[model samples]
Structures are given as C-alpha cells and as structure tokens.
Target chain A: MIECNNLTFSYRKATPILKEFNLTLENGGIYGLLGKNGAGKSTLLYLMCGLLTPAAGEVLVNGVNVRRRLPSTLRDIFLVPEEFDLPSITLEDYCRINAPFYPDFSMEALKRNLETFEMPEKIHLGYLSMGQKKKAYMCFALACNTPILIMDEPTNGLDITSKVQFRRFLAAQMNENRIILISTHQVHDVELLLDHIVIVDNRQLLLNRKTSEITSRLRFFNTLGAPDTDDPRLLYSARGVGGFANIARREDPLDEETDLNLESLYELCCRNPKLVENIFNPDNTSEHEQLG
Target chain B: MNNLDNFDKFSFSRFMMLAKREIISSKNIFLMELAVVAGLIIIAEFFISWSALPSLNDVKEYPSCYYSDSTCVSIIFVLGIWGFAFLANIAASLVCLKLSNKKGRITTFMTVGTQGEKYLLNFLIYDVFFVLYFFTVWLLVDLVRVIYVDMVYPFEGKWVLFYAIDQWNWMVALGTIALFLFSQAFYTLVSAFSPKLAFLKAFGLSYAVGFLLIPYSFFCSVVLIDKSFSGESNVIVIMASSVMIIYAIAMQLLAYYRYKETDII
Candidate 1:
C-alpha cells in the first residue's frame, strides 16, 4: 500500500502543485491517474515513488516512509518516468547489470514481455528507436515484479500497434499483489485496463473512484440531441464527429445501464466538478441534487 | 512479503553491485581514457626519441650521456606521473558528470541503492578506482616503452621507472595522494550539487582559486610573515596541505548530504 498523507509540494518560484494532497493506493489494481496538463498528476506519482520529497507531510509505502528510500523499499518499487536514459549497452547486459538489484526480477517475464512487444531480445537499448526503447524498458520494469509500479506517460512514445500490445502486456502482468499507477493524458489507451480512476485538478483530488463505482454512479451515452431527463440531470454534453451528442448523466436506479466512457467521464468531471463530486459523495448531496 | 525494515542500508554486497554496474555502464569511458593515455605516451615517446637522435650530422648534443642522466630521467618520469595524475582528474570529473548530469541516469542510480551506498560508490569510482587505474596504465605504458627502446635503440642507462622509484619519498607520495583526494572530492561535490555543466563549474572554480592563490601567497609571504621566507614557505605548504585534506572531508560530507536530499524531478 502507498499512502500520501497531507502531502504538499511546489517547485521553486512556482505556485504550489500539490497542497495538502492526501491519497492511498492499495495492492491489486491498475489505477489510471487523470488530470490537466499542469494538474500535478506527475508530481503526485513522483512523490509516491519517493523521487520527489514532499514539502510537507509524508509519503509512506507499505508503512515505511518513502523519503528514507530504504533499499528494500526501493527494491520493491519501480518508477518508469516519462523520459529516461538507457546506457549504450545491449539489453542483455543492461538486464545483467540491473536485474540483480531487485531480488524478484524475472528473466522469464522479461522474455515474455519482449515477445509480446515484438522487440528483439538481443538489441542494444541505445540503438533502438524511442518507441522501441520505451517498450524494452517497460518490459524490464515489469520483469522486476516489484510490488508497486508507477509509470508516467508510458504510452506517449508508443506506436498504435505497440500501444495495443502495451495494454495487453500490462493486463497480463497485473496480479493481486501488484499495484500499478499510471499518470497520463492519454486516457483512451488505458481505459479498459484501469481498475480505478483518480482525477486531480488544481492540487485537489476531485475523484478517486473505482471503475465499477464510477459506472454505477454515472451513465455515458450518445444521442441525436440532448435527452430530456429530470431524475438524471445532464452533467456534461458535447458534440461528436457525427450528428451525435456525447452525454454523461448521474446514474439512477430506474434508468437503463450504460457503459462508462472514460474520456466522456473525464470531460464531465472536468466540466462539472462540483456536480460530479456531489454525485459521488452521498453526504454532499444537498446542493447538487437539485441538478439531478 | 518483502520486509523493508530488515533491509541493510549500507550493505557491502550492494556497494559491490553498484560498483560493478558503474564499471559496465562506463566501459566506453574507460576505453576512451586508455586510448587517450596511450596516445599521449606514444606521442611523448616519439618526441623524446626524435629529440635524442643526432640531427643528420653525426653530432649528438650529449652523446650517450643524455639517456644516462638521472636528473633527465627524473624530470621525464615526474612529468609522466603528473600527466597521468592530470588525466586521472579529468577522468574522475567526467565520471561524476556523467553519473549526475542526466535525470534518467541519476534516477536509475538512486533507485538501485540507498543514498549512502550511492555516495560511497561515487567515492570508490572517482577517488579510488581512477587513481589505481592511472597507476596500472602508467605501468603498462612504461613496460611498452622499455621494450620498444630496448629493441629499437638499446641504451646503457638507468630505466625511468627505477629512477622515479629511487627519487620517490614517502612524505611527498603521501602529500600527492592527499592532494589527489582533495581534488577528486571537490569535483565530486561540484558534480553532486550541479550535475549539468559539472566539469565547467569545477574547472571555473579551480581557475578562480588558482588565480586568487598567487596574490594570497604573496600577501602572506611579504606582509603576514616578517620572519625568514623559507620558514614561512614551509609553514604555508604544511598548513595548505592540512587545510586541503580537511576541506576535502568537508566536501565529501556535503556531497553525501546532497545525494541524500536530491530529488530528481
């Protein structure tokens, strides 16, 4: 479990990125972290992985303060940053040099992940293209089999086919003991794989709900025009490529069930944060129920 | 379940692992250093031989005495030693720069071990390994030079290596080692604090210090001390060396703190 307790952080000469931000992640799910460009999603991931020390409060991984960066804590957690440098060495040599640091590193998993990504097993990481390098590094990261894995923009440099493969590979790698936190703006790429969704905006966590809970609480669909409904008020509505209107509304028991489209949900949450928060929070229903 | 509380913060095995990782990652750097030193040695040998040979007319300046002069051998040997030392400093600084300059590299390094282990690994690589490697390279160059001279133009003279060994004093050797440690430590601090352009920063700082030392020494000798000049010089050398060692220790401490608190964002 990773927990951020009242964490506050800010870069020098900049406004606070994360202020009194609190979060907790437990094992057994892939969390999709969503936010605007500068909404502190990446900063939260860095803090959780102990890459950046919080200005206030603390981040604890499995009951141990991440700031301490104990060897065992480091061994069990891996942070795949958006940008990384690989040495000018063959993948085999890279693994040989680095794999030993993590006692649970699995060569079999590496081979499997490489095969899944269609990457050559014996290529020099430095010589590969950016996309291929990302795939290879991701393979190595998953092979480490660390309990906590945090990836920032993992699918950024990937090609369309590689992105599909990456999703499949991530699904294959997930287990009950592992917690994967991915922070990215590319929500569609990881929509199906996400077990939980976390949305932060302006240093505040607007939503931290499981996919099931989100789907149960809200409904997403497209229609020719805005549907007339009073029980489930329209939280967000936007025009689509066709003459269709993409819409998200608070779920009601009497209404028919609809699959949750992550993109539309993200848009809805960003567009109507108060309504979304009220819909999710039972105690804060006083003001928002009027919209419903 | 992995218990982090049981993890050793400063494990010798982990230190060795980090050291091995560094060696593997820096293979190209080591090869480059070897090539540079070898090229320098070859060039120096060519120039020395060219200078020693008579100029077309059978009129040698010192005849056979040039090769046999202990003073000449000592000066050449000392130059070689200092040249290697200079190269070692460059190599050490470059290593530090490479390790700390890149965000990806620093993150990767920090992930592998505790801060203490990371700091120790830097010390081992820049301070210990580079110095030892310099001597090894020097020995190899000397052996090749000896063989080449013996085979090409046999000289009945004392070998430069033996001459250097004969001239070596323990106190001077200790002083040189202390100076080397101080320089390496200072560079390490500069690298840790400012990864990008570490070499430039260290070089600039060194130049600034060198520029100030002349005036400071002059002031100390002329105004500060009214006693004998030689006595004051001895006192200054001793005091400077002691202060350098102490400063080096302080730099290392600061480096450790920097490493521990580094947040690669």
Candidate 2:
C-alpha cells in the first residue's frame, strides 16, 4: 500500500503544487496518473517515491515512511524517470553492478522482457538509440520485480511497435504483489493496461476511479458523423477527423456500454467539474474512493 | 512510519554494495581526474627538481626559490602539497555535487542506499581514497626525482625521503596538510549546499578564505626562510593543526547534514 497523508509540496518561489493532498493507492493495480501540463503529475510521482520530500505530512510505503529510504524499502521500489542517464557500459555490466542490491531481481525475467521487447541481450547501453535505451531500461526496471514501481512518462520515447510491446510487457509483469503508478500524457498507449485512473489539477484530485467504475458511471461514443453529433446529453465532446468523440453519463439501464474514452473523460471532468462531481458524489459528501 | 527509525541502523553489507556500485559507475571519472592531477603534479615536480641541481645553480644570480637557507627545499614543493589540498577541495566538492546536481542522477543516488551508507561512500571516495591516490602519486614522483637527482646531480648532502630531520620542514608539511583538509571540508559543505555551480562557487569563495590562511602562511614563511627556526615553536604548529582539524570536522558535519536533507530536484 502507498499512502500520502495531507501531503503539501511546492517549489521555491512558486505556488503550492499540491496542498493538503491525501491519497491512498492499493496494491495489485496499474494506476494511470493523468493531469494537465504543470498540474504536478511529476511532482506527485517524485514525492510518492521519496525523490522529493513533502513540506507537511508524509508518504508511507507499506507502513514505513519512504523518506527513510531503508534498504528494505529501497529494494522494493524502482522508478523509471522521464529522463535518466545510463552509464556508458554494457548491459551485462550494468546489471551486474546494480542487480545485487535488489534481492528479488530476476535475470530470467530480464531475459524474457528483453525478448518481448525484441532487443538483443548484449546490447551496449551507450550505443543504443533513445527509444532502445528506454526499452532496455524499462526491461531492467521490471526485472527488478519491485513491489512498488513508479514510472514517469515511460512511453514517451517509444515507437509504435515498441509502445505495443510496452503494453504487453507491462501487462505480463503485473501481479497481485505489485502496484505500478505511471504518470504519462500518452493516454492511448496505456488505456488497455491501466485499471485505475487518477487525475489531479491545481491542488485538487479531480478524479480517481477504477476503469470498471468509470465505465459503469459514464459512456463514450464516436459521434462525429452521426446525426446527433451535438447531442444535449454529451457531458463533453471533441471534433475529430471522423467525427466527435463524446462522453455522457450512463442514465438508463438500456444504454449500450461503450469503451471509456480517456481523452473525452478528461475533457468532461475539466469542462464541467461541478456536474461531474455531482454525478460521482451527489450527496456533496467528502467521502469517496480512498482519495483526497 | 513505524520502522522509520530502525532504517537508520547501519548495514555493513549494504554499505559494501554501495561502494561497489559507486566505484564501478564512476571508474571513468575517477581515472580521468587521477590522470589530470598526475600530469600536473609530474610536470611541477620535474621542473622543481631539475632547477634545484647544483649544476643549474651556478648560473643563478640569487639562490633559487627551491633553496631555503642554502638547503634545496623547494617552496614550490611546499606549495605543491598545498596544491593537493586544493585538489582535494575540488574533489570533495564534486562528490557532494553528485548528490545534488542532475535530477535523474540525484534521484538514483537519493534512493539507492541508506543515508549513512551514502554519506560514508562520499567521504571515503574523496577524503580517503582520493587522498591516498594523490599522496601515492606524489611519493612516486618524489621517488623518481630523488633517484634522478642522486644519480646525476652531485650534492654535498644526500636528500632523504622524510626531507631529513636536520631541516624540520616536515612540521610545515604536516601543518599545511591539516590546513588543506580544512579547505577540503569547507568546500564539501559549500557544494552540498549549492550543487548547480559548486566548482565555480567554490572558486569564487575560496579567496574569501585567504584571510584565514595568512597566519599559517606566515609561520610557513618564517620556518622555511629562516632555517634556524625549526620545530622549537611546536606550540604554533600544534595550535594551528588543532584549529584546522576542528574546523574540518565541523564542516564535514554540516555537509553531512545538508546531504541528509537533500531533496532531488
């Protein structure tokens, strides 16, 4: 379990990015963290992993404060940052140096992941392209087999084929013992893999719901060429090359189930926050999913 | 947060792993720095030793700076020892800078090991390992200089490894080392506090410390210039060494605190 209790953080000479933010993420789920640019998505991820300390409250991983960075804690968590430097060394040498620290690290799993990514087992890190490096690193991060894995923009540098490979590789890596938090702008790349969605904006958690809950509560449509493209019921809509992608509350039992459109869902939450909030928490109560 | 306090407990195995990781990851950087420092020290030693020759001395109007009270004690050699300390200062600063500099690097470092292990690794690399490397390089150079000078240059008195106790300049050497350690520690703290431009900042602020070095330099000048002034004034040596060592310890503690509290940007 990961818990952020009344977390407040701000950079020097800047307004608070997250103030009194409280969130609890349970294990065994792949959480897709969504937010606008500069909405503190990366900051929140850093704080969760103890890379940045919070000004108030604390982040607890498995009941221990992450800031302590105990070996027991360190070995169980691995972060793949949006940007990282890999020393100019062979992949084998890199693993030899770093793998011993992580007790659960599995060479077999690494080899498997490498195979899945279609990367050579003995590629030199310095010689690989940016996308290949990302693949190699992602393979290594998964190989560590840490219980809590946090990746910022993991799919940013991936090509189309690599992105598909990434989703497959990540899905295979997931287990009940692991919790993966991915903060990314590439929603389509992760939609099929993520089970939970967390959206934050300007010091607020605008939305936190499981895919099942989101699909159960709302519906999505491709209505660009349809006659009712501007339907009155659309909570949000965006014109596309084909037509409009639409999101609307699922009001009737007979309403056909449609896949959750993350982009349209984000628009609905951002454009009419009050109505969305009413739909999710009609009683105007502070209670919701384990979130703040 | 129940076991957070227990996380501070030291682990010997973890510390060893951290050592292994740091050495392997930074081997290139370590070797490059060693090469640069070695070159500078070698050239400086070569020139100083060659000029101290009696054959080269005949052409001089005044005694060479290498001669102190008619003995071939090089001021440049003394300055060379001080130079190592300044190198140590930069070395220490660079190590601290790693803990705070790049966001990605800082994230890895901050999350890698326990604070105690990481702090000790930083201290051992710059303060212990690099110092040993520096001294070993200097001694080998000095050994070569001694061998070359003894074989070719005719001298009335043979030069010894400990610089001969007859000329008690060893005290000056020891005293200066302590002063340099203080400088190293101060720069380590400065870098820990400001990693963005630590080398430049340390260079900028180093001049402000000359006032503190005036008294020590005065003692060194007196002892080296006046051969009559030996270790008889051991009180000044003891006082200066104690002051500098204490300052070094204090600075190290401050640097450690800053490192412990560092948040990766």
Tens-digit per-residue lDDT, B1-265, candidate 2: 2363554477677677777777887788878988998998888877766666555446355333333323455454455556676687777777666655455445555455777688778767777877788778877887776666545543422333356445555666667767777777877888888876687778678766664357546645666546444455777677778888998899889888888777777
Instruction: Please tell me which predicted candidate would have the highest lDDT against the true structure.
Output: 2
lDDT per residue (tens digit) for residues A189-290 in model 2: 998899998987645788877888888889888864643646666677788788988777788858887887888787777776667777878896454322
What are the per-candidate TM-scores when only chain A is compared?
A: 0.93, 0.94
Model 1 chain A is weakest, by summed lDDT over 10 consecutive residues, at: A283-292
- Write model 1 residue lDDT over B1-265, tens digit each, in one string: 2454446457787788889988898789767866777678767755765565444344444346454455555545655655665665564455445446446544654466777777677667755776676566666665665665555446644566676667665445544565666776777788777776776788689778873235333433332223233555666656766887898899878876876777765
Off by over 4 Å in 1: A229-232, A243-256, A284-292, B1-6, B52-61, B98-102, B147-155, B211-239
- Report the C-alpha lDDT of model 1 over A7-106, residue by residue, as the tens digit: 8788886887877777889899999999898888877877787778888889998888887777877887898888888888999999999999888899
Predicted complex 2: CAPRI docking category:
acceptable
